[model samples]
Target: MHSIVFIGGGNMASCIIGGMIDQGFDPLTLGVSVPSEQSKERLSKAYNIAVTSNNNDAIANADIVVLAVKPQIMRNVVLALAPALPKNAVIVSVAAGITVESLQSWLGSPRAIIRAMPNTPSLVRTGATGLFANDQASQLQKATVSSIFEAVGYCCWVESEALINAVIAVSGSGPAYFFQILDIMQSVGQELGLPEREARKLASQTALGAAQMAINSDQSPSELRDQVTSPGGTTERALNTFRNEGLESIFRQAMNSALARAEEMSKDFSA
Candidate 1:
């Protein structure tokens, strides 16, 4: 088992560490560093992994270094920890908008680096992750990276780094979009006379069921949706309302905004 060190012990790191441990990865080989004593204590208590306040202490012997810090602070953190990182270690970054070039620059040397985008559902072992690797990274390194994410959920590697921004627009911010729709559906169900708890349950279970159907079926999502939307029926009437309201256009604009913001952040963070 490769030794893994996480540079931040925030929510995303916690989710990954927790997921990895749940999948039977050796907790003894995992390490995390956080600035706050309280955060360190929580991580140690929660995962039974090594925890330290010193970033250098965490990466000294790591085979894989996971950069989990925020994009804004990643440069400072990487530069500070560069000396501690083993020369042959692979760097895996999960932060959005932080490019591999910036990481290499901060490290002050060429290193194998993998950029990954993982959503919060990883906490439940149902996440979707997107990854991209630099030329310095080997096939074995890429496979190792894929296995780490796949343990938590689904993972795919994109051919280009630009697609990482697409991933940010889709899966990275996708959960919030789903949650917003579910919240609205739940509220509407309550307004339609169901009790709050029952309405929430109904909406949640329906959402889960629909997602399961999509996953289990060979049919495209549009085909499945069409199957459910009968001619001259209630579903059709509702769909017509959505079409008239330009829901598709709204979603397109929303995702484009997310993509644009990600690109802007990348420019802002580039070294």
Candidate 2:
């Protein structure tokens, strides 16, 4: 079995590793390096995997080392682990905004590096991840990384690294957009005389059901929406209000803002 080690045991790392274990991966093959004693103990107990505060030692012999640390500290972590990292070990960075070039430069060696953007939903094993690899990364390495992220949720690759920023806007930050809508719906439902508890559940469940339908239905979301909206129906009236208020324009601006920030972060980290 190929050994895999995660360099950080934060929530993102914890969820990914938890998903891996749930997928029947041998705990003996998984390891983590986290500085927090509490995090170490929690991760070890949670996944029955090896855990330590020593980053170098944790990844010394690993075939795949996932850099799950925050982007701000990623450079320091990579520089310190560079000498001890296995020569051919594939490095997967789950941290956002950092590019493959920055990682390779920090390593001071030519390494196969992958940039992965996984959403918070991975905590529930329903996350979506976008992955990009440097030219040095092989097909086999890509497949292995895909499987690792897929364990948590849906995972896909983008040909251009630029698309990684688009992924950030679309999926990385998309959950918050949905959450905002749910919050608004719940508040309105409460104002419409529904109890708070019932309103919250109804809003959440409707979002979940709508998501499931979008995924399972052969037709597009637009088609499904049209099918549900009849002439002068309540749905059509509400939809018309949203359209008149330029909801689509608002979303475009928000997502574009997210995309810009992602690009800005990449530049910041690159320097």
Candidate 3:
């Protein structure tokens, strides 16, 4: 078994570890390095895995190192571990906007690295992750990294590292878009006379059910939507109102703005 070390024991790290453990990965091969004594204790107690405050010590035996630290501090964290990193050990970074090029520079070598864009839903083991591996990484190394993310949910590879920003806008920041829609729906339900609790439950369940249908059915979302939106019916009226208000154009502009911001972040973090 490849000994895996998590450089930061934050919620995302814990979720990945929990998913791996749930998939029956040996806890003996897993370890975490956390700065906080409380965090170290919490991870140890919760996962029954090795925990340490010394980052180097935690990674000494690791075949795969997951840099789960925030993007702003990722450079310092990478530099601190550069000396101790195993020559061939694969480094997988989950920090947003931190490119593989930046990581290689930080490490001062063409170390095998993979950049992952995973969303918040990962905490519940239903994440959609976008991965981009550096040229130094081999096929086996890519698969190894894929297994780690796949333990939680879906994994898709992009050809160019720059495409990671697109991934960030689409999947990494995608969950919030859904949540926003749900919030609006729930509020509308309340305005229409449902109790707050009932409004929330109804809106939430409808969203969930629609998503499930999209997944289960081979038909496109547009086709399914058309199926439900009969001419002169309530669904049709609501959808027509949305269309009349240029909802599609609004969504397009919003997503484009998101993509642009993600690109800006790439530049900011790379510096």
Q: Tell me the whole-model lDDT of each prediction, alpha carbons only.
A: 0.92, 0.92, 0.90
Give the TM-score ranking, best first: 2, 3, 1
TM-score of each: 0.96, 0.98, 0.97
Alpha-carbon runs more than 4 Å astray in model 1: none
Clashing pairs in 1: none
What TM-score does prediction 2 earn?
A: 0.98
Where does model 2 exceed 4 Å of error? none
User: Which one wins by TM-score: 1 or 3?
Assistant: 3
**After superposing candidate 3, which stretches have Cα over 4 Å from the reference?**
none
**Candidate number that wins on lDDT, 1 or 3:** 1
Clashing pairs in 3: none
Model 2, residue 209: distance off in Å is 0.5
Candidate 2 lDDT, tens digit per residue, 1-271? 3389999999898899889988988999999999989998898788888989999899888989999999999989999999998898999998778888888889998999888999999999999999999898999999989999999999999999899999999999999999999999999999999999999999999999999999899999999999999999999999999999999999999999999999999999993
Q: What is the lDDT of residue 212 in candidate 2?
A: 94
109, model 3: CA deviation in Å?
1.0
Query: Candidate 3: TM-score?
Result: 0.97
**Number of the candidate with higher TM-score, 2 or 3:** 2
The sequence of per-residue lDDT tens digits that candidate 1 reaches over residues 1-271 is 2389899989889988888888888899899999999999999999999999898888888888999999889999998999888988999999988998899899999999999999988878889999999999999889878888988899999999999999999999998999999999999998999999998999889988998999899999999999999999999999999999999999999999999999998999999
